[model samples]
Target: MTSPFASKLRTNYCPSDEEVAEIKALLVEPCLRLKGLDDKITALQKALDKLTQERDSLEAYVQAHTALISPSRRLPLDIIQEIFVACLPTHRNCVMDAREAPVLLGRLCSSWRAVSLSTPRLWASLHVVDVGRLAPVHDSSSRRLEERAALIPEVTRTWLGRSGQCPLSVSLYTFPFPSDPVAPTILETLIQVAPRWQHIQFTIPAAFLDTQFQLAAKDVPILKSIALHQYDPFQVPNLAWDRLEVLRGSNVTGVAISGCDLVLPRLPLRWTELTALSTLGSRDSPVSGERHISSQEAMELISKCPQLRTLSVLFEEHGLFAETEAHPIVHPLLQTFHCRGNVSTFTFLPGCLSLPELKEFTFLVHLPGSDAYMDDENGRPLVRFLAASSHLESLHIGISQFSSSFLQEILRSFPPTLQRLRINAMSKIMWGARLGSSLDDAILSVITPGLGDAAPCPCPALKELQIDRCTAISDSALLQFISARAATLKRIQVDFAREVELDIRPSLQPFIETGLDICITHVRPTRKVSAWEGLPHAERPLLD
Candidate 1:
């Protein structure tokens, strides 16, 4: 049975004629055996292919039926609706996107769609934007766009109709296009349901505010809160001012109606009934001198409104000439006060106010120039105000700079109930000047417990600490501060002003594992340039 070519099996040697003839004679029986084996394998292969197709069909059939008996299919409608409701965006109104919740829930299946559509609360809130803003600019079909815009009225009407008489929460934004009648038509449709407007935000132009809102006053019977973004002189929509509890506006001062100048608070809103009022200026341009109140006017509102608990006002220097020293006015019911804007105007604010029940106070001072007008040392008036407010539980200070003595005195004045403290400062480079800021290791050491003998902790009940833009605090000081306060501190958030080379996570891992929330971020340092280097290069042409 041995073949002569066995020696050359693994070699490249060629066989001679006698050896080739011997190899061919030896392969005849094996060739016949190989052909018979191939036929047997072909039959088995066909059987395997048929069995695989049948198994795949059975698996698909079983999988299709298994979904019918899933546990999710037995979920109660109320429970399913609650789960669907939880998927909504809490911070903002729902948008018209299939990729997100309310809309996405409808596309799940027939049962889910029926539940979502039947739930009136799901369609009660909506954020509407003009189709022109969302349509692709590359699309050259104006007729199609016009038709799309024309459908807004119908779509809005249908959406609102699904609410089933529920109070509506809506935010509408429209760009200025007088030729397009869609915004006006949308406004009209919204006006028809004015009675159901529980909360709304409007960012329309001046013309719509003047024309449509004039007739909307009587219709908005249950409207309790409204925010306006219009800046032009327009009459107050004769809403039920007595019933309105909350009012908010941005850059909405110096409004004149029929040629009479009146500030926002000076408007004939039932000042006594308003529980909350915010006239925040736009942050895009902080010093625009648009929407702010003087210290005197703030005092007037505080003294006039007995039920007012929360007031946020931006202060500027334009209204400083009229105010002089006066006796402290006591507000018994005010709990939260947020005052920001120019620091110069904040000088007289603390001198004339006494908020005995104030629990939370935020003073974010924006330094417009190199100096604060408070000639008195260490913010004495402010310290006195904080000292008198024994119920203060939270205090937030954001200034361009802080003197060490002032910060220490304010901290010393904090009550034992103060549970939260946030200190933020802008870098000196932001103002293009070098100024003295006291947020350093020394100040942090002051707050760190057990560091000094017999030095009482400022806020013993403190549970949260947030510090930002204080570049002078080192890693060791921050770590020690967190370690000392680890028992009481539940949350710690710090944004280092410069790059941190050390990873402090290993040192604080034990505290984090024990349920302490921690977040640390670093700001990348950029190359510093001098005034001369920032000047235009000699090669570029100058502008006219």
Candidate 2:
């Protein structure tokens, strides 16, 4: 039997060799199919890349169309120019370093730059700062100053030339004192075209007087306003400024009365002219010498200005007094008088109070630390003079001396035509107290006579009340007053009060129910309660 089995194995009787080949072929068929699948995958990836490119192209086209269809893109060129000019800053700056303005307009499109360039008013105002920063070459600090000085005039001329005959308002500020001397040349050019100049401001150092005077003498009759900063007052030369209406002085460290005197004769009394004068300095500053304008000089100059309506006289170390026996009267047409100084007592000499047309008056009296005029009989005459103004509608009185009697006299004497009343920094007074108990009581007594027949009722015609930094008003008394007079009250504003416990809600509830306006502002005294949230709706601001 073993011999028979060996013979069969040698003969390969189970299956033929061709059957094995067939099995191998079947396994290889699956490998071939996998290779075909990989080829198809590569093709699909290529198709995906093509689709992605097409999608990106479509998105870019849509963005372009959207931008073109925007309303801003459709605005007329003139309107667009107006928008650009509106973006210019009104605040005066010595230098403007930002380049985004013209550049941005230029980059928008060719048409925009054309429109912007054509609008002369768009370029008439020029402000330059740190001209040295625009230099192409690095130089020593001193050299940079020289280069900046030389470049200033050229830059100004270029801007003005582009502006054509349009009026120019130029502000030039530079530092380190340039040796280049271009500013004078530019100013000379401006003087030649003086009629085209409307406004000019200079913040240059005091060393540039010669250049300034030369330009000022050019008789810029069209110049309406001129402002000088950090310059000698005397260096300002006289000109035929028939159209000049406004003159301002800033950072004036040096006083040259000689120049002012020379220019005074040229200033005529034109009814249309209005002047705003201001000076600032400490009592000990050297600038005080130049700041003095004698009463005689002031009167003489003002007499020529018959049409003058508004006058603001501010003095630091001095006061207006009877300097000359002439005692020239102020313009009869004057309507507003605002004066501030250390003078504790000022008497509007017999005819000084002749401004019958005066409407608004503000007087700030600062008492000397050891002065006696605040308490003496000397202030009586001044008080009487102020009380006699019949046309005064708005009166603001600030006193350094806290005297109930003095304040009471003023309130009792004030003109009945008054409409607006503001009291600040007053002492506290008890409600229903005696007249002499506190200054506040005196004030209330003076005003009570003008109110309704009731004790605390406000003036019938009074519409607005503003109280600040005053601790004298009692909550109950104020509430009683408002509740009785809420029909006439329109608006009330309070800030920074000392009495935090005063709850005005009960008194203001009537106004809120009737839809009248009321506003009250105060700080939280402690973290115990939310004062703002707790306030009544009428006293709280409406939020969106």
Candidate 3:
């Protein structure tokens, strides 16, 4: 059949008007009919969409009912508890955040919240930052956040309450002094839980802690480890402190005190029971005319601490110990001793103590402008000390400024059994004479060409090596250092190797592939600021 909308045939040379009209005729009615069908199709699509939505709703309802009868609800509580324990904070996330671990577990069903809350260990670790230092505002317009002081205590209460009777590893820091109201409130709240505190770090003023020691003494049957700051060494109370026992017939086992007056005789610490003692001098602030500890007093403490495993002392000035040859206090179990101080202090330390088991020793001598490598008062004593500690496996020298001959002399005298060595050439406090610290050639010369005994490598059993801020060393020297010990080199970390002209990624790839963990951070050409340290909770890292 002929289509009606097709153009009509014209017969005449110039077609009549009627013929032209027929040719130009419109299909309006047919088009209108198709539009009606399109409208109908649109209505049907809306209906289909409505039906799909209803079907989806019904499917969701069916799944909900199915879930109610699911076998997962019958999972044993012990298994759920194990899963909850696994969800607790890990090392990478040392502080618990709201989206992680116990907090995340609590956000689930009621049963899960109950399991998380009941796990005492989950709540035992409380890491808090000082609230007072979070926002410092000195204007008269906005008063210091005195109102938020109550918030700290409330949170502390909730954590301690949830912890039940579990022993706590709490780092409680309140910055500044007793002036901050939040400091006192938080301290008061923590003291209420004194019996449960197993390991604690309190960096507040000594006044805040004075009463707590007595409170802790009464109820704390085993206060094993403590780190205190802003201590007044001479403030040791005259009362029969001996009666205040921290452990079961033992004093606190491990202790670290910083920024305190130096008076060993009046220390609240019990020297006899300590396994680790860290008496670090304060570099942050030094008030002249304040009482200081003599080398004689330091030796006395070491002599008394028979069970001490680790001892760290940083003396600011020369030690004027009265005796040149004090009776050598033999430390049978001493493993690590880190000493950082002026030349005279280190010169006197070795003669006072005999450590048979000393394994790691670090000596960082601050060289004054007047000092020389062979300073009559300083250099020879350290040599004598090195002779005494020939058994040491690890030795670190922060004082890199030395005459090469002087360093070679010391290296030659190193114990044959020495393994791990570090030369930190970038300590900020070390002044002058680091010109001879291009240590690669000197160090490599000591090692023979073969592995272990075949070569006379200073450290045969050396498993790990760390080189930081050694810009003078070439890539060849550093690589050769590792290659010499490839058989025993399990790990190597090169920090701030700026001057070296090798791409670490491609150059060290083979060593990495063979099970070496290599970390290289190229030196930044700018200075970096120190991280915040005022509060126990670093920068208010509280769980939100």
Best by TM-score: 1
lDDT for model 2 comes to: 0.53
- Model 3 C-alpha lDDT per residue in residues 1-544, reported as the tens digit of each score: 3554345435335657886686456456667888999999999999999999999999999999999988878888888878777776664222445677767888888888888888877787776556464355576433445454546677777877888898877776554432454656777777778777777766655555555545535466557877665543345333333333442323368876664443545456666788987766333323211234456666777878888899877655544444456676787888999876655666676677788788899877654543533333446666676767757888887645455556655665667667777777552323433433455544545653442232354556777767767665566666776666777878777776574377647767888889987776776545434354455676644231
Worst 10 residues of 2 by lDDT: 249-258
lDDT at position 345, candidate 2: 28
* 1 against 3, candidate with superior TM-score: 1
lDDT per residue for candidate 2 within 1-544, as digits (tens), equals 2332355556647755885576566568678888999999999999999999999999999999999899987898778878887766577522323365543565667877787677776677776543333343566875666665567667666667777787767755443333343545555655555667566655444445333544332355556555444333345443333323222222111111212222444433232354433232222223221233433445554565566566544434444355433343645776766655444224333234456777777765543342322332445645665556667676666544535656655555566566655555443233533222233433554454344233433334556666666556566555555565577667666554664566878768878788656666666654443446755764644443
Residue pairs in clash, model 3: 128-537, 129-537, 401-433, 401-434
375: Cα error in model 2, Å: 6.4
Question: What are the lDDT scores of the predictions, listed in order?
Answer: 0.71, 0.53, 0.64
* Model 3 lDDT, residue 17, Cα: 84
Better of 2 and 3 by lDDT: 3
Tens-digit lDDT string for candidate 1 (1-544): 5765677898989888998888898999999999999999999999999999999999999999999899999999899989988998998888766898788999989988999999988888887776544444455686676676777788888889888898888877664332454667888888788778877776655456656765334566666666655433234333332232223222112111211122564355556676666666333222212356677778887887787788777776653463456798888888988888665555668878888899999998764564653323736777788778889888888745555566666667777888888988543444566554647777777678876332687788899988877687888888999999999999989988788867788999999999999998888756554445546664534332
Q: After superposition, which runs of candidate 3 have C-alpha atoms over 4 Å from their true positions?
A: 1-96, 99-111, 133-150, 176-181, 210-216, 231-251, 281-292, 316-327, 367-393, 412-420, 427-441, 444-455, 497-500, 525-544
Clash totals for all candidate models: 0, 5, 4
